[model samples]
Target: MPQLPEDMVLPEGFVPSQAPQPPAEPRDSATVALVRDTDGGPEVFLLRRVLGMAFAGGMTVFPGGGVDKRDADTSVAWAGPTPAWWARAFGCSAELARALVCAAVRETFEEAGVLLAGPDADSVVADATPYADARQELVERKLSLAEFLTEAGLVLRADLLRPLGNWVTPPEEPRRYDTRFFLAALPTGQRADGSTTEADHAAWQRPQDAIADWAARRSGLMPPTWVTLSQLAEHRSVRELLAAERQITKITPRVVRRNGNLHVALPGDADYPEAS
Candidate 1:
């Protein structure tokens, strides 16, 4: 059985329970792990949520958020794999698949200042700086992704994204999310910046280096982020990593009490405990 890292600490006020009085329903969300090729390996973009935030505060994570209702609007132009294809890949409805892809692209731009879209089907935006105003509006929710794309005369390049995994937040948490993880390579002529209010810091780091930081207590990483980085560390280049085939599966880690302390157990652990 895999053991929770010795450095792992339960959230403040967290108490192991068989079940909450009522478990919060997981909200549909999406996250994108943006990577760029480097001499050492692929370096992934990460954002450290501001400490004052409610969820995953002070933890490094990818750029993403809950799906917006407007994300499902079919009026938004798209190029690449159809929604039906994404639905099959993620084991979700076509409508939700469309929303997830849109959310992924939208959130990446809103949070990282990196747009995974293009003026047309054949190319990606070389620079995102020109859309600063729209990006902020998108962050403020004043403009929906569909509206922004439509007004900008751009298409959501669904082909630029690849499904990484699906993870459901455990039932013990007050806030939960059914999150689909997506992998996207940093476009050639664009740069990622940490301008989002949610994050206090942003940087690009090799997966292994980030893991080391977590191990040395220099940074905080939630389980999902750690696991994703570990998986990413196995590949040497962005192209190789993106080309690797993945089998999408839902993984829900469980929290349990052991010797008066809380611990997390992955699905295949020797004696995985259920919170509900």
Candidate 2:
């Protein structure tokens, strides 16, 4: 298990309750780690969420968000692995698997301006700048991913995504999410932008460098992001990283009190049993 920094402080408004309370249900969400091969190694795209956001405010994260209701639409033009295949991969129902995949693609576009869909099944959009208006509409909930793809005559390229893992927010958290993480190579010609209102800064950083930034206290990384970066740092190239087989499992880190301070404990930690 990866270790959290000793100086780490909980996010704003994340105070634990004084008395035991029922854990809030976690909302289904998707997150994508966009990557590209670099001379130095594989670099993953990350966005620093604006400090005022209710969830992971001021933390750097991959492009992703909650599954939109329309993301589960069966009418979405899709290519590559079927929802059933994805269902088996994530150990969820096919309907939810479809929604998760669609959410991954849609959120990637809305947050990063990178579209994984294409006009035809065999190709991906070379440039997404033309769909700026649609991106806004999607963000504003005025358009569903299926509606946008159908009108644009494109198919969601499921082949471009690979399941990374699933993480459920700890029950102690007032706001929680059952977030599925996916990895996608940055499309060849599409450039990612940080224009979304959710993030104040965006950039591509080599995974190890990101970990280093966290170590030096220059950037904030939640446990999931930190662990993902550590895992990515072990691979030498994008192909290697993607081709590496992953045994998808659910990892729910728990928050515990340790020596009068709050700490996050992974499954294997000694204090994990005390979490709640």
**Per-residue alpha-carbon lDDT of candidate 2 for residues 1-276, written as tens digits (9 for 90 to 100):** 456666665643366554238778899999999999999999999999999899988999999999888899999999999999999999999999999999999999999999999988899999999999999999999999999999999999999999998999988778899999999999989999967999999999999999899889899999899989988889999999889899899888887777777777888787787545
Candidates in order have lDDT scores of 0.90, 0.91
Clashes of each: 0, 0
lDDT of 1 at 227: 87
User: lDDT score of model 2?
Assistant: 0.91
Worst 10 residues of 2 by lDDT: 11-20
lDDT of 1 by residue, 169-250 (tens): 8888878999999999999999999899999999999999999999988999988888899899999999998999998988
Per lDDT, the best of the predicted structures is: 2
RMSD each, Å: 1.7, 1.6
User: Which regions in candidate 1 have their CA more than 4 angstroms from the true location?
Assistant: 1-6, 15-18, 274-276
User: What's each prediction's TM-score?
Assistant: 0.95, 0.96
